[model samples]
Each structure stands twice: as structure tokens, then as C-alpha cells.
Target: MKVAVYPGTFDPLTLGHVDIIRRGAHLVDKLVVGVTTNPSKEPMFSVAERLEMVRREIAEIPGNIDVVEFDSLLMEFAEEQGATAILRGLRAVADFEYEFQMAGMNQQLNDDIETVFLMADVSLQPIASKLVKEIARYGGSIDKFVPSAVAEDVRRHLGAGSR
Candidate 1:
């Protein structure tokens, strides 16, 4: 069976993320969403919270998708999960440079694993987890930026009531 690993911090999975996850699911027999911690940025949500949020968001998606948490290198995680590819989302040119560099390094580490990039939907292209948290932090409406399940969590995390 062909398996793909979509690895990301996913502090709070946004609509753009959902778009990618939905599309990536169809390309592989199984799509494992790997929620990991990024040492470079302090996340607003805990790893467990992120995993739970992603699971809830994808529970109804029509595919063999599962959520997993990891802290080690993505390549190692992919190998451990028997993944044939690593799925990533490309929202804009800004995302390409960093993803490109990481893709090269990941390839060097494991040539057998392929990296697949899926462009975000036009309407959801600007959505990002960091920006979503920022908007929510300042009491901005995140209903359109994230999934309904995630928006509630974001509102609660930011200490805001129902919107």
C-alpha cells in the first residue's frame, strides 16, 4: 500500500491545511498527518491539542487518513511509518524557498522517499497557522481561516467567547 506522510507543526490546522490534507489523501492509499513541534517557534497549542484538533477536523474526510505526533526528524518518521512520500502544501512563492530547501535535504537523507507539493486553493492561499493565531490573539475573526472545530478551540485558547 502506498502511504504518504504530511508533516507539519499544525499548531492549529487552518482551512488551507484542510485543503491540502483533503487533496493529498486521494493520492495515496493512506495519508498520515504528522503533527510535530517546531523548536523555532513557541506554539500556542500543545502537541496533544494539535493532534486532537487535526483528528476532529479530518474525522469526516473521505480517505484513509490518520493523525500522529512526532518530534524526531521527518524523514525518520516517514521511514518508521513506511511512507512512500512526504506531502507538503505550497501557498505562495514565500513557501517555496523554505520547502524547496527542506525537500532537497530530505531527499538527500532518503532518496527513496518522494516529496509531493500541492498548491493551496486560491481563496485559502493566504491562511497560515501563525497568522491565524495572531489574528485570534488580537480578537480577530478566524471563522473563515480555520475549520469550525478549530475555530472554537482558537477562540477558547485566546480567551474569547462564541463569535
Candidate 2:
């Protein structure tokens, strides 16, 4: 049973996030979507809200897929969750640079764990959670860049002016 953990803030899962998860799903027996709570980063949605939104978005994903929230090092989280690998989504060169560093660190922390990178779908390459939230905050429609569940959550959050 090969399990892979995909960790991210997932402040609001974007279409790009969905694209990567769907692609990574085919490569692993189980995929755990780990939403992390970053202290420095102000999230647009609460952890519970993000988890619910992810559940709604990935409802069609195979039963092997799981959604959870965490606030710890990626390597530690993966080990605790019994994940044998880490899946990362690379959208551009900038992403590669950052993921590369993190992958190296994770490898150092846990030799049994490996990191796999999946390219984001071309159509969603430019979409990001931060950008989606920014656009929606200014009253711009992100209908195409975000999943329906995420869009609804974004709309609800923005409506109440809660960040």
C-alpha cells in the first residue's frame, strides 16, 4: 500500500490544486491532501472551512483519497500519517525552485520518504489560491479558476469580510 501525502496551505483549493491532486492520484495507492495552518500566512478560509471545501471538491476522488488538516513539518506529518511519499504540484519554474528545496529537506529528514512532482494542467497553470482569493475579494469572478465548492466558500467568506 503506497501512500502519498500532498501538503499545502490550501487556503482555498484552486483548480490548479485539483488538477495536481487528480493527476497524482493515478500514481499512488492513496493520496492524502494535507492542509497546513501557516502562522505567518494569513489564510482566507479557516482550516475547518478549507477541509470541508476540499471534501466537496474531491468527493469524486477514489475512496483511497483522504483529506485532513495539519500544523507541522511536512516530513513529520507524512510519517505520522503513514505516507510513504510526498506529492507536490509544480506549476512553473518558480514552483520548482521552492519545491526542490523542500524536497531535499524532507529527504534528509526521512530517507524512506520520497517526493514526486506533478505538473499542473496547462489550463490551470496560472491559477493559485492567493490569486483566486485576491480576485474574488475585489469582486472579480473566479468561476473558471476555482472549483464550485471553493467558489462558494470564497464567496461566503468574502461576503462576511472574514479573512
Candidate 3:
């Protein structure tokens, strides 16, 4: 089976992420979404909370998709999951520079697995989890960047009124 790992912090699952998840599922027999904690950034949701939210967001996707939490090196985690490829979503040239370097490093670590990059849907290209949380914390409507359910979760966490 062709298994791929799409790993992200997913602090708040944005519409862009959902777009990638749906499209990524079609390219592999199983798409494992890894929710990893980034030590550099503080998270609004705990790993458990993120897992539940991710599960709810992907419940209806028509494929074999599952969410798991991993704290080790991504390549090692991908290997553990039996993934033949590591999937990523790109939105801009800036993103490409970073992802490209990371992909190259991962390849050096494990030449057996390939890294695949998917461009985010044009309309959702600007949506990012960091910016979504920043907008919510400052009282801006984030409905455009994330799903209604996710927007609500952000608002609730930030103690803001509904949009």
C-alpha cells in the first residue's frame, strides 16, 4: 500500500489544510496526518485538543485517513508509520524555500522515502494557522481563513464573541 505522512502542528486546522488533506488522500492508499508539537511556538490547543479537532474536521473525507501525534524526528516517525512519502502543502515561494530545504534534509536521512509537495488551493493560499490565531486574538473575523467550526474554536479559546 502507498502510505504518505502529512505532518503539521495544525494549531488550528485551516481551510487550506483541509483542502490539502482531501487532495492528498487521493494520491495514496492511506494518508496519515501527523499532529506534532513545535517547541518554537506556543500552541492555543493541547495535543489532545488538536487531535480531537483534526479528527472532527477530517471525519467525512472519503478515504483512509487517520491522525496521530509524534514528537520525534519527522523522518523517523514517517518510517514508523510505514510511509513511502512525506506530503506537504505549499502556498507561496517563501514556503517553497523552507520546505525545499527540509525535504532535502529528510532525503539525506532516509533516501527510501520521497517527499511530495502539493500547492494549496489558490483561494485558500493566504490562510495560515498562525495568522488565523493572530486575527482571532485581535478581534478580526477568521471565518474566511478557517471553517466555521474551527473559527468558533479559535474564538472560544480567545474569549471573543462569535463572528
Candidate 4:
């Protein structure tokens, strides 16, 4: 089976994240959505919350996709899942710079697993979980960036109802 691991914090799955998940699924027998914690940044949602949110968001997607929580190195997680590829999405030049370095490091760790990049749809390219949280924090609508269900999740989490 051609398995790919799409790893991310996914604090709140955005349309861009969904876009990549949907598209990446077609390229592999299974797409493991690895939900992990980034100690460098404070996350608005807990690891459990993020896993549940990603599970809910991708539940309707048609593919053998699953979400798993990990706190160790990404390459180790991917290998544990039997993934032969690591799927990623690029939104802009900024994303490329970061993903590029990460991919290089991942390759060094495991040359057997290749990293694949997919560009988000033009319309969804601007949507990001960080920006979505920021906008909702300030009482702005996030319906455009995230699904209605996720928007509600964020609003409920932030107690910024119906903005």
C-alpha cells in the first residue's frame, strides 16, 4: 500500500488544510493525518481537541484517511504509520521556505520516505489556522477560512459567539 503521512498541528483545520487532505488522499492508499504538538508555539486547542476537530472535519472526505496524535519526531511518527511519503501543502513563497527546510531534514532522517508538496486551491490559499484564530479572537467572521462546523468550534472555544 502506498501510504502518506500528512502531519500538522491542525489546531483548527482550515479550508486550505481540508483542500490538501482531500487531494492528497487520491495519491495514496491511506493518508495519515498526524496531529502533533509544537512546543515552540502556544496552541489555542489541546492535542485531544485538535485531533477530534481534524477527525470531524475530514470525516466526510472520501478516502482511507485517519487522524493520529504524536509528540515525537515527525519521521518516526510517519515510519510508525508505515508511510512511504509525507504529504504537505504550500500556500505561498513563505510556506515554501519553511517546508523546504523541513523536507530536507526529513530526508536526512529517512531517505526511503519522500516528501510530496501540493499547492492549495487558489481560493483557499490564504486561509491559515493561525490567522483564522486571530480573526475570530478579534470578533471577526471565520466562515470563509474554516468550515461552518469548525467556525462554530472556534467560536465556542473562544466564547466569541456568532461573530
Candidate 5:
């Protein structure tokens, strides 16, 4: 089985993320979406909440996609899951530098695993979880950036009226 691990904090899954998930699902027998916690950034939602929200958003995708929470090194988690590859999404040139470095480190840690990079769709390229959260912080609409389910959760957390 060709298993691939797509690891991310996924604090609140945006549409760009769903786009990558959908495309990545087609490339592997099983795509494990790792909902992890990033100590560098303060997340608005708990890991449990983020997992639940990701599950809800991906419920309709017809594939062998599983959502799980992990707090270990991504390469270790991928190895534990028996993944043959690590799936990542690239939005632009700026993202490639950081992603490339991580991919190299992951390769060094586990030479058996490969890293696959998927380019975000042109229309969704501008949407990012950080920017989405910033917009939601001050009552800005994120309806276009994230799935409705995620937007609702963000709105509820931000104490904003539902649209």
C-alpha cells in the first residue's frame, strides 16, 4: 500500500488545505492528515477541536483519508504510520525555501521516505491559515478562505454573529 502522511497544525483547515488534501488523496492508497500542535504559534482552537473540524471538512471526500492528532517529529510520525512519502503543499516561491529545508531534514532522518510537493490551485494560492485567523480576529469574513464548517467554528470561537 502506498501510504502518505500530510502533517500540519491545521489550526483551522482552510479551502487551500482541502484542495491539497483532495489532490493528495488521489496519489496514495491512504492519506493520513496529521493535525498537530505548533508550539511556535498560538492556535485559536484546541488540538481536539482542530481535529474535529478537519474531520468534518473532509467527511465528503471519497477516499481512504484518516485524521489523527500527533505531537512528535513529523518524520517520526510518518515512519510510525508506515508512510512511503510525506505530502506537502507549496503556494509560491517563498514557501519552497522552508519546505525544501524541512524535506531535506526529513530525508536525512529517514532515507526510505520521499517528500511530495503539490502546488496549490491558482485561485486558492493566496489563502493561508495564519491570514485567515488574523482576518477572523477582527470580525472579518473568512467565508471564501475556509470551508463553511471551519468558518462557523472560527466565528463561534471569535464570538461573532453567524452569517
Candidate 6:
């Protein structure tokens, strides 16, 4: 069975994320969505909270999608999880440049594992977790940027009214 790991902070899983998850689902037998816990950036949601939100959002996806929180190197985690590849979503040239370097580094760490990059749907090409948080932080509507459950969480956390 082919398995892939998709790693991200997912402070607030956005529609763009869900889009990639759905697309990545079709390409692998199982997808382990890793909600990375980075101490460098203060996260809005706790690791468990972010994992729960991602789990709740992808519960309907058919291909055995699961959420886990990790703090160590992602390539190491992927190896331990027995994933054959790391799935990533690319929205623009900037994303490509960043992911390319990371992919190269991951390859250096684990020669067997490969990185698969999926292009985000054009409608969501400009959407990002940071941008979504920014919009929510200042009383902007996020109904279309995040799942209904995630949107609610962002609203409550950011102290804004629901869209």
C-alpha cells in the first residue's frame, strides 16, 4: 500500500489545505496529515486542537486520512510512519522555490523517499493559512477560505463575529 505524509503547521487548516488533502487522497492508499508543532512560531491552536480540526475536516475523505502531531524532522517522521513520499501543495512560484529546497534536503536525508507536489486549484491559488488568519484577525469573512468548522474556530480564537 502506498502511503504519503503531508506536513504543515495547520494552525488553522484552510480550504487550500483541504483541497490538497482531497487531491492527495486520490494518489495514495493512505495519507497521514502531519500537523507540525513548531516552537519557533507561536501557534493560535494547540497541537492537539489543530490535529482534531484537521481530523474533523477530512473525516469524510475515503482513503484512510489520519492526523498526527510531530516535532522532529519531517523526513524522519515520514520514514518512521513508513510513508513512501511526502505530499505538498504548490500555489505559486514562491511555493515551488521553497518546497524545492526542502524536497532536496529531505532527499538527502532519505534517499528512498520522494516528494510529490500538487498544484492548488486556481481559485485557491492565492489562499494561505497566514492570510486567512490575517483576514480573520481583522474582522474579515473567512467563510470561503476555510471549512465551516475551522472558520468557526478561527472566529472564536480571533475574537470576531461569525461570517
**Residue-wise C-alpha lDDT for candidate 5, range 1-163, written one tens digit per residue:** 9999999988779998999999999999999999999899998888988998989889999899999899999989998999999999999999999999999998899999999999999999999899999899877999999988788888898884432
Off by over 4 Å in 4: 160-163
Q: Give candidate 5 regions above 4 Å deviation.
A: 160-163
TM-scores of the models, in the given order? 0.96, 0.95, 0.97, 0.96, 0.96, 0.94
Model 1 C-alpha RMSD to native: 2.3
Q: Model 5 Cα displacement at 160 (Å)?
A: 8.0
Query: Which model is ahead, 5 or 6, in terms of TM-score?
Result: 5
Candidate 2 off by > 4 Å: none
Give the per-residue lDDT digits (tens) of candidate 1, residues 1-163: 9999999999889988888999999999999999999999888888998988999888888999989999999999999999999999999999999999999999999999999999999999998889988888887899999988788888887774432
**For model 6, what is the error of residue 48's alpha carbon versus the real structure, in angstroms, after optimal superposition?**
1.0
Question: Which candidate's lDDT is highest?
Answer: 3
Model 5 lDDT, residue 92, Cα: 93
Query: What is the lDDT of every predicted structure here?
Result: 0.91, 0.87, 0.94, 0.92, 0.92, 0.90
Backbone clash count, each prediction separately = 0, 0, 0, 0, 0, 0
TM-score of 4: 0.96
- Residue 143 in candidate 1, Cα distance off native in Å: 0.8
lDDT of 1 at 55: 92
lDDT of 4 at 29: 96
Which residue pairs clash within candidate 1? none
Error of 3 at 127 (Å): 0.8
lDDT of 6 by residue, 11-120 (tens): 88988999999999999998999999777777888888898899999999878787888889998899888999999999999999999999999999998999999999
Which pairs clash in model 6?
none
- Residues 1-163 of candidate 3 have per-residue lDDT tens digits of 9999999999999999999999999999999999999999999999998999999999999999989999999999999999999999999999999999999999999999999999999999998899998888888999998888988888888774433
Over the stretch 1-163, how does candidate 4's per-residue lDDT look in tens digits? Answer: 9999999999788999999999999999999999998888778888998998999888999999989999999999999999999999999999999999999999999999999999999999888888888899998999999989989888898884433
Better of 2 and 5 by TM-score: 5
